[model samples]
Target chain A: MANGTLVLIPTPLSGQPLAFSHPPEVLSRIHKITDFAVEKLQQAVHFLVKTGHPVPEYKMGFHPLDKHVTGEQLQDILAVLQQGRDVGVLSEAGCPGIADPGARLVWLCHSRNIPVEALVGPSAITLSVMYSGLNGQQFAFNGYLPVDSHRREQTLKTFEGRSANDEQTQIFIEAPFRNRELLGAMLELLQPETRLCVCWNLMADDQWVVTREVQDWASASLPENFENKPAMFLFLATPRQKAVSGKKSARSKSTGRGSRTTGTKKGLHRKRYNPD
Target chain B: MANGTLVLIPTPLSGQPLAFSHPPEVLSRIHKITDFAVEKLQQAVHFLVKTGHPVPEYKMGFHPLDKHVTGEQLQDILAVLQQGRDVGVLSEAGCPGIADPGARLVWLCHSRNIPVEALVGPSAITLSVMYSGLNGQQFAFNGYLPVDSHRREQTLKTFEGRSANDEQTQIFIEAPFRNRELLGAMLELLQPETRLCVCWNLMADDQWVVTREVQDWASASLPENFENKPAMFLFLATPRQKAVSGKKSARSKSTGRGSRTTGTKKGLHRKRYNPD
Candidate 1:
């Protein structure tokens, strides 16, 4: 028998409800799905109930499909699909299968010739790139850069090299706790005029996105609460942005030093650029 | 005075109704906004009406924003922000500021230090990568490949090289009309064992997404209706998938060379791999 369809369901990036980000049509599909392959069972159940999807009172309604999902478990899940029950794959955040363990199921589906559907939803990667105001035409998302100091520097240099050659914006993310360290390295390693965009807490009420040159951000102090928070970083080596930087320096010279203020009293902020 | 935000609006990717893709909350935002920067005025008006958004009967509601949007016009649009009216940007399809003219305004917003908001929505690039079953952890969206034959070949080789180096998936798009040509080049130029994924017409009833190795696809033919239709392609050079191919070759020796059948005359069809 042909396998049942595998649906890749995208969950909320933050605490917002499903309808706040997903279409009515997408929600309808979720309502009809019973079998779910999820990273976190508790969060998945919470999401399903909050989104108004029918879930049985039994704890077995959601199947855990984390990084540890074994091939035998995948086959066991496929056996359910062979019986004609559709399954939904849910990631911990954002889109399923991208930078998530759900890709294993997607890969299995391809191998078994099972049908698959990827529902559209909020992807922080794409959203960050869009708001970065960089090269939207060409860009690369290097999910998580190396954590080691030496390897991280080499990777950053590699990204800068690729960006200059192709006029492509390079995007990468950092663990919540390591954002401060990552920001410091970027300021020290990337070229002085490279345009950088840093975004924190997307899709929430306190969402903030800011872009500036590395040189201007050298002396900038990050927000007090941003020490351990999810953030995205993007840098562009394009000619147009470099031109913008040139125009900005001219404007800064006329307005006097330390006149450009960028911080706020709110939780998410970056202080004025006062590179001495 | 602070400027009103530059909102990033997402449009439907295919023939689906606007409500079928955008959440009610996102639509509400569209209903209240009067200022807009859109690629096509007629399509934008049509989309707004279909989703119950309020648009003035007057023709001036939509401001033309294409590749030709000028600096003066961007400044002209920025004037609306100065008057405390938030502006919505709509691409012809998918998210604004991504592979569209809306980025110019976004770039301007970042340059002028105006606030910007990118709402959560559908993005074809991410959707394709999610379905590719490749290395989603690290991927590159190369936008449109070069039109020149030699340049296109070189780009594909470079992508394959990178994918091999870091296990990064390389994604690129082509004009719907050139998909056949592009696929041909991919199978011919890319390594025989490199995994290739092609996704066409995402989010619609007729959506199709398929992933297989380049060798298995060598003798395959594209669907008849695939000509001149929007599509995304992704490939990865990784050890695990190569292992899958090796196991498949052994299975082929036992079952037969032309036994891999993958399609049905269903809503979405993925063709078979006939390696004969």
Candidate 2:
């Protein structure tokens, strides 16, 4: 019987080594496996070398997404599994099978009943949610919106409608070049008071996570060099209610049931907004 | 200028040894940090001792959430902070201000502009998302849903509507006793075809992470022993599209975009359902 492959090891973000602290241990275990698939052979080699634990001897199976990976490369990976050798897969950064290009391979592994174990680690998605201060309970993460204006607008409208009724938080990302344009479109289309958060260069020394009202964002002049920067955007469906002060009144019910309330609050101001 | 009086340190889930992780290093940095606002004073003390670190000679401040933390105890924490002494806030598990009980204090710090720096460590949210096989680009982490049937239903409906139109993923949690009940409710109220991923006892020896269709879930009865177990629930807005087979034909378009047409073959008996 063949040993199951463990795929999807996440690497740390740039300058944020602590995000995924388990990769080293995971890599060590991979060395004991007979075969291994890596997103980028060179990058993986460098990582192993830097960590002082290079793979001694094993079959190298590069994934199709890697520059060195090809149809033949995939076959090599499958052949290793067929030979009953345990296989391990690792991504270049953060989590595998995310925006990263390891999904197809992982899916193939899943279909084959290969045992896949994903270790816990840091992810930009969770970090962004933690700092956004938006509704965390119900959120949808839409990956990079289409570059085309028509498709982009359609995507934005779709998210807008989703957040219209419930206090759902909608998450999306855009290539740095199109961020400003996307923000502008959001300002024009989304409810003026909808809450929006932008987390840029997260976990790095220059990380910036800021939340503001959509209208406030619309009115601000675009930064001069707004192109080519990686960024994540979070939009809250319901306007954050101002936090209540003072003691609970006699009329305050403990049932904790609350309805959706809406109103336009002016430009980004830090205040507690929990209608409940 | 008075130096910042607040330090936010993230503890591990199992309260394991720190070794050389970021949390302990941050804990050692405070020069005048006299009072430590810990969730569990005895556990924190035991952890500090087990890590072979010198027990700080400073006074200990415990939060009310701790077995001994109370309103009066919180006032003690505030008093120490007001006296210009740095106060370190630690949670019983995972990172502070995230699904943990330190957020109210963090809010107090934010309101007062008391500088707050969060050190990194193990986070269940980050771990769960890493394995969810859902869109990671945008997500919301609603801590735990209300236990009441009406309120819980209302909250679920609100969350469901948020991701209906986009590829956003929504995440929520429930106490151990209500896990099966909540899962049952979710299967009924959510789109039957929506994909659901559940991570139970994350990072522990018996950890289980499963992503399955809701309909598939409805057909089977879950074991009752899961009550009181810590579990994280992730619902993707849509099922990811399968990759195109290599034999598919590529069609050229006038708009310079190429389209691939492939015939779908039925092989595996995988369930088909739209998460939306």
Top model number, TM-score: 1
Point out the worst 10-residue segment of candidate 2 chain B by lDDT.
B260-269
Give per-residue lDDT, candidate 2, residue B162.
47
**Residue-level lDDT tens digits of model 1 in A1-276:** 667888888888878866678988888888888888887788788878877766563734567786666667777778878888888888777787776666667777886788888887888888888888776766777655555676678768877876766666788776666778888899899998888998887787767787878888855557788755578888876343332113222322332212110100000001111111
Worst ten in a row by lDDT for model 2 chain A: A260-269
The CA lDDT at A270 in model 1 is: 12
lDDT scores for all predictions? 0.69, 0.53
lDDT of 2 at B8: 60
**TM-score of B-chain for each predicted structure, in order:** 0.82, 0.72
